[model samples]
Target: MSPPPPDRLARWLCHPHFFKVVLLLALVISAPTVAIGFYADDYVLLSYLAGRIPGSPPWYDLYNFFDGDALKLQANLVSGFPWWTDPGLKLHLVRPLASALFTLEHAVFGHAPLGYHLVSIALYVALVAAAGRLFLRVLPGATGALALFLFAVCDNHLHPVGWIACQHLLLAALPAVLGLLAYLRYREEGWRPGRYLGPLGLGVGLLGGEAALGGAAYWIAYQLAGPVPPGRAAGLRARAAAALPALGLLAYFAAYKAVGGGAANTGGYVDPLASPLRFAAAAAERLPVLLGDALVSMPADLTSALPSGPFVAVGLAAVAGLALLYRACLPAIPERERAALRWLVPGALLALVTSLGGFPGSRLLLLPSLGIAPLLAVVILRGLRRGPSPGRAAWPRRAGAGLLAAVHVAIAPLLFLAATASSADIARKLEGVARTAELGAPPRERAFIAAASDPMVTIYPQAILGLASPDALPCWSALSMARASHRLTRTGPSSFTLEPLGRTMLTGAFETLYRAPSAPIPRGYQVTQCGATIRVAEVEDGKPSRLEVDLGAPLEDPGLALLSWRDGRLRRMALPAIGEAVELPWSPGPIGLL
Candidate 1:
């Protein structure tokens, strides 16, 4: 059997009208989001809007919700933060454009979630279209079309599109992509308007979110590696002019710091400007994981699920193997495609660096995927065409390419489809948990969650309740966030100690989300919240080994109720009597897998 002619094959692979397909795929994949109501930070945003969570900024300034000290006071009052939360924890962000959008949506839609989901879907579709346009500009023909297709169906879009709070990711991406497209036009077509429009678009993107910094990386990459104009002086001038857009990043950073907008005292987020070394360390640790995710189909979210040492090691190995595989296959790639690779590879890596401020997740891959999609498309297309041909000398490269193609082309789409459904289902489950908490807890009684596998189950329910009925908001404390079996020993009439059977508290990835390594809780440290005092009883390896909780009431008090997550459900559990010990089994609740 003979392969089809080159032109025929190219025709089959390329779609000149790929944007339409991208739009359709975006719509189809994101349709399930309409069923997903408020989850995680969406509840917090809504609660703030409802005036339930005090100290939050006005609607337009809502992105600065974590900036004020008043919120910390409010958190202490209601046990909003976990017991392990850093005393000076700050998760401030400057995103006026995204905040304004949220404000506008809430004013118009109020509590009806259908409107928010629709807006998020619309933004996502726009972002996909923008990305397709950018790809077509940089990588023409079959490669560009394939890149658009790969990006359109990428599972990374699931979170940004489905989760309302994550709309900022979409908002940031859309303008950033447009800016890159404009910059490309300036470099490739000599468009005068593009020089100004490119910088303008990036500036607007910065207003959307800090994720916009990734766009500046592409600008830098183009200046460094993109094709130069005919005259040497003219090319230098053009490249120098391209630096204007990157200035937006500097300006954004300056303004952000001026306004006291940045995350601090949290292991989950590292501020690059404030703590450069720590940020570099985090980026170094996270970059490989993100690279593995982009190069192959290794889910970036696994960083949270698995131990850091093993996960980072495996990710680093995958990155090294993929780099070598790409190097082996590079000679087979056309010079034009290889030229694109020079910029694409660097742009993708730099974009990934921009996202390392937060924990690695599929959601953060959106910006990097812009460059990776095209790079992968070119490699995969060339590999498929040449690797399987008879008399190929590079059998090793062929096998490596074949494996890459199998994972990305065959398996990735199925994972995307599954992720689309899974994202919606996770939101539904979280909402269910919030609803259960609202109904199960008595109006006046304080609730204590004995054990919850996921932090979302513990933190967000109170905010959800505040949104639903602020007047009757219940105070609840999550005793344990670890997904491990524990031995609950009753120490006194009003105090109980929880010791994990095999692990120390606040050591897991999710557990560390609330506490930074720099602000470790001392053994005798105590936090009083909602009539209960939580004390760090014992420490092991710099982590809490035993946590003693003083309920301020007898275990048999009818005013207090104990709840434990079991079999994916939050159910009331019997309190251990004084001098009694009870075993608490680990259960991955609805959002645990996420």
Candidate 2:
């Protein structure tokens, strides 16, 4: 007796060797990341591990890199905090498991970046495997394979995989999927060990990173909508057992708050414990944007490019459209697949809520992608089976499915490859900036950048230089991060007033990362650090318009080096004579990932 067409297709899709092909495709697509080298915060972490940065936490607690007092100290010592940074800013994260892994890797790999890249790639492969197992368990057969393919090819994973510091996302996601799978087994198959294993995985995920909070959403969703064992008492017991994981989440939160580990008084991150109302508002605004990005391929980073009003409106419209299409296609989908979506849709929504504590980006969509991938896969599969000619009445569903298939199947793979290349390009550009700074200026000179398009160019070069030579560590203080040309008027031998060619300062996306809008720097504010003094000389619309910098030496002093980003490289700028005015042109540079 032969099986039906659907069964035959399911067997073909689930063939043991087909999954290997998917894995291979993913590996090939992401292979470029292995050569990207250290980027952004990787330099900072490396310098701290090498004891080059004073007042840094011990190796085991390396991720606790920012706190109010610590930032003040670092600002004083090395000009670590940019001039625009808020004095009251507190952005601290505690990820012990990730720290421990870094410690071990540092011990073995030393400063070589290739070793770290290899480790990150290994973790990425493991995460992909875990996601495949998860899709199989929940959706099964052809649908599961399609989901795995969609997930494996997603470009969003590039950030976590390419950047060594972001491996915690992978670390958190692997156990999270496994934990959910274990919980499902315990409920559906009467497995005894899964009860404890489920919570254990959740606890480990918390240790991995705070992003693991997304895992708790799946547990909650399963408890609400997942299949229940036969009999009233048995079903009740299964549901009650699910609550055990919440204890782990509570313990994690309690410990995190006790250690004073959370974002505070910053617009970049909203701590639910400290400011519940603010967090709620942020989550609401971010949810639609995240959903639109995950479902219909809208870029979530558009929040940075577009004004809040228009961006949120577009995002809301996208979400509404996707919801309608999902509803239209629901009846045609198999009951088993429909059952999976019951929990997966809500689970993905809840998971997205967990990511709202920080800024919105596609990188934060990893856990949510778990639910999204299966949903998209099933819908695309249904559309393909129905063929293209389903009449005008079904045009909307056909169009929606076609759009999704085009985005995920064709465009996403290309984007994944481009993202890998972009990471490498960013690493190269940052290295160029570091090397240019190192060669152009005198050794041990106190360097102050007159103007740069991005803050990473100002801060990262110092860390990169420090890692190269700890004894002769480089010191750099940024005067402005506004993406505008500047008029440098030398008021005195040691003082100059820098007026931006544009209206205001610190308005760019990278600049605001250090100082959020909620805590704006007032005019007449002054700070002296690293042999230089900075004052906000004028204000425009509550943001600085001009900055006055006193270098503590004559304008032509050999010990002073004036640098600015130009033509894709950091170059030494000639100091202006006293009472002379010069225009410092600003050239846009690569906006590296954070």
Candidate 3:
């Protein structure tokens, strides 16, 4: 059917208070995330700032940030840690206020995960509210509600809100933008913008290094959507006026640095330039997971419900609706009206780009996504105006809205399922079973069985680390641990050690050898004796053994034998594959997974 008239659509949208009320209602509805568990990254940031150790450091703590690897940049900030090698490395350079606030929260909340979750949830709610406020002001007659929903769950943010660690993006962005919005409102009233001095200053100060980033983002949005000045001289003056806020933003950023204690050491991560290429290449290969992440962080079982098909569908639909609005309504918007939107959309885009430096995910995109709501609302409003008649106007908009809302409903339960389906609970149960299963065996007998069943904890020069099966542990944790330890330490140009190996190495190496690889055995084993070479046969019973070897011998073998180590219980086995390593199934006693 053909679309109805425009005036009727405009009349429907021009309702006096629907926008504000609906916006408020949405905030009220989604505010409960605070009650949820602190998802992953929330734990990391909070723990770091509060200086709490979750457990022993994994072997690679020397280079990893979680191990205090980022301590090199700071002048005097000493990291509190288990990984003590790089104590003052400055890893996080930009967000001192975030770290400081985390410390403050810890002081008040003291490792209560709930408190962190609540703060994150509250900030999310506030951000939603502020977005609504901005929408009401900028799009007064637009479909602000659609924009609000889009901001909430359009991307892979479902789990990000729940994840306690990654909520900093939202937490920092909310107050900073709300403060600017308030300042903008004050300015619109022709009130002395100086009255905003308090809120603006506080927001910037609280945000610290992020203040500049946040302010720059807001200014970009303002420039895009605020009124363009009348011609040359006036435009210059307007530009200068805008520059004032920019200056204020920059001043606070500098102050953040001056406050000292930037992030300790930037952690030895894959370089950003390197990551984008890897990400791009991995994009095609891992589209399913990538898209899945853009929707929610559910457990594997929940993936079926919120599958990639539906996520891509909703995302595409949202894009279509946005396109319609931008195409149809943008031309009709007044120069001044369009200014604010122009300021925000591009600004938000810029923020998104910067935030995605080496990685792009729901958590990283939260603020930028939230900031663009006003622009999106403007689009939806215009789309609504293009409808046929008053009765028909909202029908198309409603259809689009209904689909969007349904997506949220379909997605919410999946999020809950994910939170509950933790592998940690599974692993704990497994350990209990193992204790009973091995009951009454002699210590040596038990050790051999343990080694046979355990995941390898360490990979020596000749040995490879391994992990229990994914069914026994969560794939995420298994993968996480495996990745944490499989690297050789990079010493000066000439020196290196095997400590750089991360969790992935243990898992992969273990899986390969434990599962069996197609290769021939290198038959002979040689060990050093006092000025002599000695040969030893592979032990067949999978029991602990110590075979003496000659030292100072120039035999071809370099202690090249497979060993299964558990609680110091060692079993010598034939090294099956030369290029690949094997993993015994037992967990390591003195191992960490940071």
Candidate 4:
């Protein structure tokens, strides 16, 4: 059967424009979930936001782009202290937007995961659509769609899209790419030179927020891809011949700085040239991982790909298609049909400069790689369009296009499934309420217990509607409080001074308090058992502070100090340690070891 000549739907599906739109639709579907609750770098920001921590809302909390006062809104509640939280120099505020939106969702959804996750998914979807549309507009063909799909589905992209905190990177890339597209169009038409200024200006402004480097990469690509007089020599001299784009870039840089653009400094966090050899190796190694991530669903027992048998068959077909294009089809390609290849050189260079871990990291490659996709797509589609007789070529072209399309589109459902499971796993780990009960008595019942339980979980206060709501601590706030006070803060028996055994003994006392039945021991160091209590008898400060317990754990070592209040009335213990439970009585502080 001849398939009764293609119907409107069939023709539309095969149309390059339709396929591009379909890709756009896929992008839209992915955006919402990509903007959900904070992840990765967000933890640093959230640490500063907790009311229990010493620091108040930080200055330039969100990329520091806006006025100082706006950033202070996220401070810790109890102490009106401000924290300059980010180690990275840039006041990148992308997280603030995500945090603010998540905060709003928190108000309405009451900590349910779905609402925030939906936002991230939606943002990713929009990003994918924007990228596809951008490519199709530049070069319309099966190849264009294929390139966009590959960029979208590639495994490296999963981290940026799936992780909520990375939305800034995505949001920034979208407008920047659009602006490049607009600028390219402006240049192509020899339109009013001043008109090129507008899109260029917008691209720079957006670049300041998500990623300055990404914006710079695209600008470089534009200059490389731009048309020059046919006889002009390449390199710096060619750019000098027509300096409009250079001027535009200069203006863009000035505007971006004026708008308060800067990225967080990662000076010590990641060595600028951390193991370039290793990174390159990792990138090469990740190719298979990326492919599997993009194409396979989680818990692989549920779904599988066509075996290697079919993959080899398809690979052969693709190779044959490429061979036919160069050998038998190149001569037929129209002269005007080809665009300049000058851009690829610079684009490749730009990609190299920005690439991290070779070719795999999405944050590093996504935007720069956009330039390469369309060019590859056009070449591939052109080959398919010309090979075989017109009648025979039609089926092969359509089949090839479909195969490419399937590979890209299938990525979304697979990624979606994997992300769903991953998010669920993370959510389960955060279900602290149930775990809190297992400890028996509330942590607050004793200072030692509270301190001991701090590692496992500690719920701290958050300011709610202008009221300091210390008791109603959420998991995020609690974890932030525990980490900031116990780890970051610099008040305590020096963690460095304690031997491994001493530290464990000290930690075990705190844990014991939380496990103990209801009782009031002492504010600082005292033990309550069998009705009466035994407090530390004396204190001496020499090389390290020391205390004498009345009737608790005996000295495991003379160096170990027994901290007590008043033997009865000390307000607090500066730094205390216990030798034995029966002789040297001691209690852990509310902030745990700190």
lDDT, candidate 4, at 406: 52
Model 2 CA deviation exceeding 4 Å by range: 1-12, 70-77, 232-241, 302-314, 387-389, 438-443, 592-594
TM-score of each: 0.93, 0.93, 0.54, 0.52
Local accuracy by lDDT, each model: 0.77, 0.78, 0.41, 0.39
* Tens-place lDDT digits, model 3, residues 248-351: 54565466445442332222212233245633443432233332333333222222222345544544544556555465455556654466566666676666
lDDT of 4 by residue, 1-594 (tens): 443222332344357476556566556545544333444333333444443333334523333322223233233211211111221223333334444544455456653445655655665666677667655554434444565655665544554566654555665566666665566555565446534653564454344343434555655655655555345555876665444444555664465456554332221111123245544543433333322322221121111111233433443444455345434334544433244324642553454354333212334445554654444444444544533356764565556544544544565456554554554444333232222232122222122111212322222211221123343222121101111112111122321111111222212222221221112122244333211132322222211112222212222222222222112121222433422122223332222232
Instruction: Give the residue spans of candidate 4 off by over 4 A.
Output: 1-24, 27-53, 56-60, 63-125, 151-155, 193-212, 226-236, 240-352, 355-363, 375-413, 431-594
lDDT for each residue of candidate 1 in 379-400, tens digit (9 for 90 to 100) = 6666555544547556666677
Q: Looking at model 3, which ten-residue stretch has the lowest summed lDDT?
A: 461-470
Error of 3 at 37 (Å): 2.7
In angstroms, how far off is 211's CA in candidate 3? 7.3
Q: Whose lDDT is greatest here?
A: 2
The per-prediction CA RMSD against the true structure, in angstroms, equals 2.5, 2.9, 12.2, 13.7
Model 4: weakest 10-residue lDDT segment is 476-485
lDDT of 2 by residue, 359-412 (tens): 677889998898889989988777545534567757778778788888898999
Number of backbone collisions per candidate: 0, 0, 70, 51
Model 4 residue 60 CA deviation in Å: 5.3
Q: Flag clash pairs in model 2.
A: none
